[model samples]
Target: MTTAVLEFPGGRLTLNRPGTDDPSLRAWSSADELLLQEAFEHLAIAPDSRVLVVDDQYGALTLGLSPFSPDVVADSAQLGSALALNAALNPACAAPERVFSWLQPPVGTYDLILLKIPRETDYLDWLLRWSNGALKQAGVILAAGMIKHLPDRSVDVFARTVNVEKVSRAVKKARLITCSQGEASLDNWPGIWKGYDLEAPGARVNAMPAVFAREKLDIGTRLMLPHLKPAIESCRPCARVLDLACGNGVLGLSVLAIRADIEMTFSDVSSQAVLSARSNVETAYPDAKASFLHADGISGEQALFDRILLNPPFHEGGVVGDHIALRLFEQAAQNLSDTGRLIMVGNRHLGYHKSLRRYFSQVRQLDANPKFVVFEAWRG
Candidate 1:
């Protein structure tokens, strides 16, 4: 992570982001700038305005609007970390309080809600529904994103509820959509539960709109599923196993079906992901001894594990790289027993075999296909 300054209309902010020192990768985006700039110019922003910010990738929107002292809601804990660090660098600005997306929002209605439009339309629809009830009767929302990064149907989704009131002119490859409460309700939104079945163990996987691999099994996980049973069975009785970055708890549920005696913990940075995984396990295996953590990697877990089954994500927010996975590997090494092993799945080109050796004494291939490969690493 490195420091980058965002020069907005009123003032500038110094922020830090985890991974990659690329000069091209700044902490804030064109959308962040345009959203704040437009709001300051067009909207009535008083010192006592009840402001709310959602999906702020880092601290840009919250810190930029520090005069009003806005509140934040985010799905990613990584974003919370970035905002905290960035606030420290710019000591004069006050950092906004953040709540997880799956948790209860801060009390009271908000006069304004600033959002960074996400990449998923389904999630966007859910957010719009949630925002409608959270906003003051006469309040407005400003949603912004890079044109290329915005979902194809994002504007259409916004048109339904918290209806799109106006569209800002394109500035620096970014656009902002102004919205106000409309005659819409979450009557049939994807706010309910749903699941898909895995043929072999019949584990019903559940995922929400914003979760990773929402409705179907991704290729990498499909390649890694067959290898999980053997790895779970190989360890001694009552072995502790972790589904690191577990999205829908499919991997952990599959382990329970094969060996129900082991202890299980599933952790992911996405708060919605943690909720979806917990729902899947509770629906499928009511008595299954499983605990869930909504934190980055394994930072919140205290117990070491005998086997760690990981299908680490290659991308964080929208930036694609191996830095996130590499950090997970180092954390896995710290949380694994001396003879414990880590079984991970990655694209064949990532060359994780070399990276795993940096943390473990030995690394070997477990399975592979045309596009995906699985590796097993352990130190003796």
Candidate 2:
């Protein structure tokens, strides 16, 4: 992929978004530029300043402020890959001192904290709580996001944990939020909720703030659960199963509820999602053969599976499209055994039936409701 240059007043660096082939998808957004302009031209960031950049999207916020050698904290494994790619392309840019989890708050106080405001409400609240705890009493925070994507209650959330100083006027449909250290204290920001209980499709589930369907099972996953038993019948004893893009481990947990013979693997891009899934599975089926991975889809997975369950995400952060699902289909095809099959649930409008044919010889409709469709794709 070709690289694009992000040129600010004081520095310039090359960046690339590695997950897609679309030419129009640039690594950085208007909010990234606006944040850098506000930080360099207006605010003060000394050479020796302690900084932490969170949820950098691609590499804009971190790379744009590379001079100060800011520490990196984000939930997405893809973000870590993006930072590595962009840093290598721009060799002069200093690497982050520590690439860590947002759940694991920084060791010491920071002079400045930069983040791209998240869309999830509970997650945002958690971010603010930990951020406030790590921020110096007089430290500053610059949170940026696209105006269309920014939730109306986001500033209200920031207000709960931090002192909302000001909001920038929309520039190129993007806005930046400024904040000072708040009085709110952190409460189980990174750990699983002791009493988080919810009814999933066929089992109980517990999820963190950022996980998809944390409070309850979504209609799509619920619609897909009844079809899982039929798919498992063909599997031999102790067959391996994979739950791609598994959120909160509900799908795999549901499968485990039926039978404990199969070894289940759950993988997702979000750190919190994986941790939540791990806790849910370990708590319910203490001896069930299960593994959780924080990954970009099935990127490094080489093990062949008898059955692959997927409810692929159509959106990445603020952007929505079918590209994410399409990519997962390709990976699933490569990893499925010759006679193995893939069972998937998705919105009916996504029309995955036709897309599945690209990787599999036969695409059979197992079940369907008004809004969702379950498909089984396998080699003839």
Candidate 3:
């Protein structure tokens, strides 16, 4: 694996994606270097302090802070693995006190927070809310991202939680924003949205800016949702369900609304999607049994499910790739109970049917539109 080495202050770090094919894909980005410099110059890292590092990508911020504090929070399992692998390569850097593999905030309050803006807006919103409640009054929140991807809305969201100040821009296409605690307000912001009355209620769905097509339903999902009726009808009442790549929990929400007695579980790689799904599930089915987890598909669990609903992601970060979606399918197959089914929606051009056939007893097209198709794969 190719990795980029970053040197600053008292530490030297190497970053890389575990098992990535590209040897040239180094671990650190220019933005990462910029954030490192900013942290060294302005942020005070106390030996006894607990610092939360959000969305550190390949552990740039987490590894960088290892010397000062080992406490860290990472939202992605893949990133967490990469961080562990990199740390193993260099035994000198102190390992984090605790590393969270999911999107949920770390358990305790912190004195300092280092945030690298995520690709999703909804995740960013959830982070702001989590930080507002978890950060101490004297703590400082420092965030950085490329100027182009850093939305103005992020600044607005930060303003609502704390007093924010933008620091000088770095040559590496990045800028840093510092947030200080202030008179806290009730974080009433809805992390999930559930359409009720007109739409079936009891589907807790939250939105984060990072959720793909968050403001509105994705066209692919819209097309696949109708096909779910057949699968839902065929499903046993109150069957255990899994919403693989559950996005904002739209598919799962729809399923819950129709089958009120069914139990649903939502999973997604994006922290924003998980938060949104959790909120939506809570709002729509307050008393219903359902849980949302931040996970990389079926990697977090081995239990088989009766049904799995998926709108798998076709890309990984900025790179257009199908490895993630393919993995989701492979795992879904391994995790399905006997007589269970994996119902998914995908673009028409992608040859997922072949993949599904390899894993399931039968793979059939449930429905189709101009650009997308809903597929069903049953485990014998």
**Strongest candidate by lDDT:** 1
Q: Provide the overall lDDT of each model, using Cα atoms, as 2-decimal numbers.
A: 0.83, 0.81, 0.72
Off by over 4 Å in 1: 42-45, 191-194
lDDT of 3 by residue, 55-84 (tens): 777777777877666466665656756677
Q: State residue 122's C-alpha deviation in candidate 1, in Å.
A: 0.6
Arrange candidates by lDDT, descending.
Answer: 1, 2, 3
Off by more than 4 A, model 3: 1-4, 43-50, 100-104, 107-111, 120-139, 152-166, 178-214, 236-238, 286-289, 354-361, 378-380
Candidate 2: Cα lDDT at 234:
71
Tell me the number of clashing residue pairs for each predicted model: 0, 0, 21
Strongest candidate by TM-score: 1
lDDT of 1: 0.83
Segments in model 2 whose C-alpha atoms lie over 4 Å from true places: 1-3, 41-45, 102-106, 188-203
Candidate 2 backbone overlaps, count:
0
Question: What tens-digit string does per-residue lDDT give for candidate 2 at 226-298?
Answer: 8888788778898889988998888898888777899999988888888888988888888999988888878
| lDDT for position 84 in model 2 | 83
RMSD in order of candidates? 1.7, 2.6, 3.7
Give the clashing pairs for model 1.
Answer: none
Candidate with more favorable, higher lDDT: 2 or 3: 2
